[model samples]
Target: MTAFEATFEHEARPISRPLRIALLGYRSDPFVGGQGIYLKFLSKALVELGHQVDVLSGPPYPDLDPRVGLIRIPSLDLFACDSHVKALRWRHLRSYSDTFEWCSMLTGGFSEPYTFSRRVAKYLRSSAKPYDLVHDNQSLGYGLLTLQRRGIPVVTTIHHPIHRDRQLALDAAPNWKFRLLVRRWHSFLRMQEKVVSQLTNVVTVSEQSRQDISGAFGICQSRIDLIHNGIDTQTFTPNSEVAVDPWQLITTASADQPLKGLRFLLQALAQLRPDFPQLKLLVVGKLQPSGTTARLIDKLELASAVRFVSGISTEALVEHYNRSAIAISPSLYEGFGLPAGEAMACGCAVISSDGGALPEVVGDAGMLVPAGDSGQLANGIATLLRDPELRKELGLRGRARVVERFSWQRAAIQFSNYYYRVIANADG
Candidate 1:
């Protein structure tokens, strides 16, 4: 039986009735990334429970539930344009924020998080409605401080701190120049670290993330709350008809960064290819062609065996998971490891590393190996590939695990409960 069945079996007791919620995020795409999916389903789930939801987001805004109003706060994302570096028009230069965004990207600094926070801060200040609570999705900025000062009940969810990204990049840097560039690119982490430490009533995606944030940012663990992220078990269920071609494997790599450990997965594949020439990988994200992941792909010469597809619908991604013989999560670290959870939910025999929260997500249902260990990853994949019965058993167990523990409805209700508690504490 699924976890949902157990959660449903127990009668849910509500401490408070519905209230107005304002969810703040920089971006919200249901499938483009996890944050968007978080906002989309969360808003919908909140609405389903008779709460009024308004998601205020910036560029690459979310496709949200129609019942939940989406407030767009635009930012200057030059890279998102069809044109390259030449795409910047003179008009774009007129805005200070736009100029900052363009110039920062040119110089290798990541300015989106800062700029988006500025935009959102301005928006919240101008809004007419008074929300019972303001829930921020990892955009830890002075803007949240502004909301709190305004006497709005503020709670921010840090999926994971960006400091982890910085540290990972530093570890993977091949030279001093690249290390400097990596540090520059992660300059936003300084702001995030500062903001997170000062923010009261913070929430996180997992217990592992809570510990990581406390260790990385020097924040008090008691100030942070754990709210496990959810997966749509109904949507990601298994399809036996999904044909697995060759020694096929699927994974989701949203970015071509070292942190995702795609390079590690490639190395594992390299070791396996000698014994299994039929091995192929299908990634549910695009390859930048010239980026680090792309370069790694070229170095491995597995370009023909590996495929990347992005911007697909949720159903399409589930189909990709269902069709694969196995799903692998090669991330060096994850706050919640959504790909692991989603793949397990889809009934794909999962081979994940003990990277950050992956073990928490995969649990005892799927195979676990050491993070950054290519040999173990290769062996786990080989084991699943060779054993059909084992794969089926693992996959079935995984789907059941997800159905019991991770669901958007449960997460939303939990958030609702937390919001009331935060408010009660404040009132007290």
Candidate 2:
């Protein structure tokens, strides 16, 4: 049976009142990654639909909507501090969870998801007022089943398997030490994988991700709900006043990760350098000064042609999208390619690699290149640049696609309906 086809003792009834929702996240710093962006927009969208939403998050909290209550689920937050070792206090050593968090970081492990889930389970166990449903933002910790066992209806969104990242990182690792460290850091996957098999109500953003979750975690497809995330077109809309730079290109990527396919984009840039010397590339991500991406940039001698920006406001991001001649998404894989959609929403001509659900988002609105193919990427960008009329056509069509297919209002309605299904299944 599909997610909605499940029957419950509650007879799988539709909800009549506003839902009491608790959205959980281990970490949600927008500048850090896309999870923050997901948390921020999803909560806002739910509240706009008349749902009562409270975001429960760990340190490096997300920038949330005013109507969404923020419940701080504090952690050691070692990642934020200048030094993970120095961040630990004497009192922190007394608490096993805090000490585990600190020591795990010190040993190159990520303990936040497992640790945060423990805290949430403990807190909700004592909560006098119960929520209708708990929505987990890819945290997949054992505590989800803990909540379910305690009569709490839990719904979890697994964007993609971190195992993909771990394997890719190992392939990109410079040596055995780094590869071992990457494996150690992602040890929390053991818990996540186990949690996926045990949970009955699960949601995923794309069919690609749903299949991936099924394969990677040994779970059945029937339990996974497919709900596409919405684009905030209001903020990501086209600004006619922002003039495009004919020779400029833009992409949002995790610069240090091999999964983002940034290396291939850089290679494409290098291939086009001789003919398009005036071409400039703008990346909306932090380039770690001492990381692999920075080294590649120096090796490619692209410092002059490329620029990196981070911590910018949404307005600025949309401005960059508006000004770019073409926006490219070269991800090796994605649960859902949000940057491509956001760029499309801003009326930016997009050229996305056939990575994961990118084709689902781009459709016929923009160009599609083979993932990790620098030659194809270069050809696509050069083709768009040589034809301004074609570029303009693609940009207009792209925005129209976003308007027709994706919106937060629509997503909220879908999620609210799924929440009821999960609640009903739990009630059964």
Candidate 3:
């Protein structure tokens, strides 16, 4: 049985009454990454379930549903600014959080999670209103302890142990200097580890993530709740009108990120060029000019065969998926594999790496190759390319699986049940 199916067997009883919930996100913009997408969809789904949801988020705010309220918790947002050193002001000195954020960014450390949590904790303490629960999206900072001490119920979702990303980046760094910078940037993991270990309730997106979180944070596997993320079938459905391009393959990844495994995909693309010269890749991410992926593209001479686009709307992204013959996810590791699930929802034949929780998401619906293996990825792509009927069959199956097993409504129901249990235990 699938993880979702197993979870359903021991499902907690759902709360009869609507909950007043607060979802916390440090940086919640859909374009920023999956955390934002998680907040956006999860809030929308919870609202549909008749819950009054308020998203308390830091800068780069999420695009949320009209039913859900947004409580802005402003931060330095130094990364958005062109020059972090110049962005600080005398006014910043008034607030320790702001000062710390500014100084941390200047020194190549990410302090958003810690600072955002501080701001959020202060907001909650001062506000007259009380929430039934506060659900935090991976911002596992020390401030959560303050909430716990105040008799507030809090559940944290750690998408995956970010130590995986840190390790992958350190491995990919060209020199000791670069590796040192990577370590500095991910220094927040120390705080996260401490926070997670002390928190009463913690959750993750997949079983793979649960295992990884347990190992990375030294937490017990049984303590972590597993909730599979959902795909928006209504928005990402198959477009029958759009003609699929036979030569087009699409993938969504941060082009320069070592964990995204764009390099392996590019190498696979290079290997298939001689057999299928017309094959081209469409990347749904920004291209960093000086990044390793850019250099690899030049080295492999696949620039002409590859294209990158970013800052696209959901409608545009769905259209791109429809236009493509196949979607590929070559990530070295993924917590939940949103790209692969989105592709499946769009009825696109998918080829994904067996990275982290990708197999849990893709299952038998799509082709799976070992992560970071160019030869296997190329072979999988070539097989799909040569067999149109197989691609069509996989596309239909993928769509069916998503519609059946993955939906925001189902996820919200599961969340509500989990919330009910957390609150009951706290009260008891």
The candidate that achieves the highest TM-score relative to the unseen native structure? 3
Model 3, poorest ten-residue lDDT window?
1-10
> Which candidate model has the greater TM-score, 1 or 2?
2
Tens-place lDDT per residue, model 1, 1-428, is 22322343454445368899889887676665788888988899899888999998877878887999988888765658875467677998877777887888888888877777777767777878878888989888767777777777889998887788888779878899999999998888888887777787888888889899889889777777777898988788888787865388988886567778888889999889989998999988888877888887788888888988888888898888888889999888999999899999988899998988999999999999999999999999988888999998999999999998888888888778788877887777
lDDT of each: 0.83, 0.89, 0.93
Ranking of all candidate structures by their TM-score, best first: 3, 2, 1
* lDDT of candidate 1 at residue 20, scale 0 to 100: 90
Off by over 4 Å in 2: 1-15
lDDT at 375, model 1: 91
lDDT of 2 by residue, 1-428 (tens): 46353332133333367999999999987777777888899999889878999999998988999999999999988877898789989998777789998889988899899889989998898879689999999888878889989888888888888888988899889899998999999999999988888887888888888898889999888778877878999999999999889999999987898999999999999999999999999999989999888999999999999999999999999999999999999999988889999999999999999988899889999999999899999999999989999999999999999998888776777788888767887778
Task: Tell me each candidate's TM-score.
Answer: 0.92, 0.96, 0.97
Which candidate achieves the best lDDT against the true structure? Answer: 3
Q: How far does residue 252 in candidate 2 sit from its true spot (Å)?
A: 0.6
